[model samples]
Target: MGTIDFDGLAAALAVHGLIPRGGIDFAKGETAPPGPSGASARAVLLVGHAGSSIWPHFQAWRATQPAGLADPLDAWSRQVIGAVAVRFGARAVSPSDQPWLPFQAWAMRAEGLRPSPLGLLMHPVWGLWHAFRGALLFDNALERPRNPDSLHHPCDACIGKPCLKACPVAAHAGGGFDYPACLGHVRSPSGSACASGGCLDRRACPVGTEYRYEPAQQAFHMAAFASPSIASAPTSGG
Candidate 1:
């Protein structure tokens, strides 16, 4: 029942490499699924990370675990974000929920971002190297203006469209993402390159070159990506 300090929350999250992507007033919006109907919702803030900002923290946390957890990153994020939400007086929701949250739509609205040809949200600076970790819902509104569209989209300007061509199986082909084909290829021996370094298609993006995740970080994500149980885990962008 006190004023929420958005800046303080953002700084605290950054210590764990989680950054506030954006937030929007949802007081008048439809209820998010799995959320108790008629609940007093107010605003929703999106969380994300860039590059290997989260790598060190994640690995350090992983060192304490017994091991063999199907998706350690997802495990770690949920635990941490859930606790943070309590302190901030908000509700924490993840994309991997049994009844998934519409994180994609929320992210697009929050950040004024659009999906790239690869079917992942694009950032003018982070390209495909960033991802939504989760969202925080508050019972009070916060002022945050939507970001403006860039004069030129990174994918639109690239005549070569390297991402589409880089995939061995054309998983992101024909203007739509082929999830099954992508999963199949990642599970094959031929997918070793991608499995080891990260998605070949994602790395091929020319924008945000400086923001690319280190090979080690990318490998960790790739490992999770290739896992069937972790496949549905919520992470957009990288």
Candidate 2:
């Protein structure tokens, strides 16, 4: 019932390297994410970063935390985004939360994104270098449904499909991701390029080459993905 200045909210979040990716309004015949009070929200705004936009901010914050913090990136996202939600009377939720919210689906709908050969949502400009950190669920519809008309999916026209060929293990062959093969390769002695330089398949995507994550960022994500204790591939696209 209360009004929100969506642009103003975006500006506030940008100060901390968070961008408003997109959103869905239940009033427009779409389902919404759960609100803070456990009720269905009226609208949900996807929050994320493109490329290494949040790297510096995250590093600064990480420096202040205790050493060996588990899931520091997720912790930082929750904290920074949660503060903004409080100011706007909205509820902030993460992709890692229980009953995992449909973040990938929400992102595709909100941004007119399509999955690339690598299985990550591909942006026309950012490619697979972007990711959803969290979402803000509001009690009221904030805007009209987004029009995906002008948003183009880049994969269809890419003739070479270098991303599919880049992997040494052909983990993306046959239109499906070979999770075990990919994981094993990343953890192997011969997988130094991927372990230290990020997933070769992802880096091979020609689009958004400018947005490719820096070496340190790529290494950090690779380390997480290679960790024995990690149950799954990192959801973060960095």
Best by TM-score: 2
TM-score of each: 0.90, 0.94
- Cα lDDT of model 1 by residue, 68-175, tens digit: 976688788898888888878878887777666778888777777778888888887888778988888777667655555333457777899888988999988778
Off by over 4 Å in 2: 27-31, 144-150, 233-236
Tens digits of lDDT, candidate 2, 1-238? 6787887898988998889878877665456666766778888889999889899999999999999999899899999999999988889998888776788777777777878888798899988889889889988777665747347779999999999999999999769999899899988998999999999989988889998999999999899878777865335455
RMSD of each: 2.4, 1.8
Clashing pairs in 1: none
Q: Output the number of the lDDT-best candidate.
A: 2
TM-score of 1: 0.90
Q: Which residue pairs clash in candidate 2?
A: none
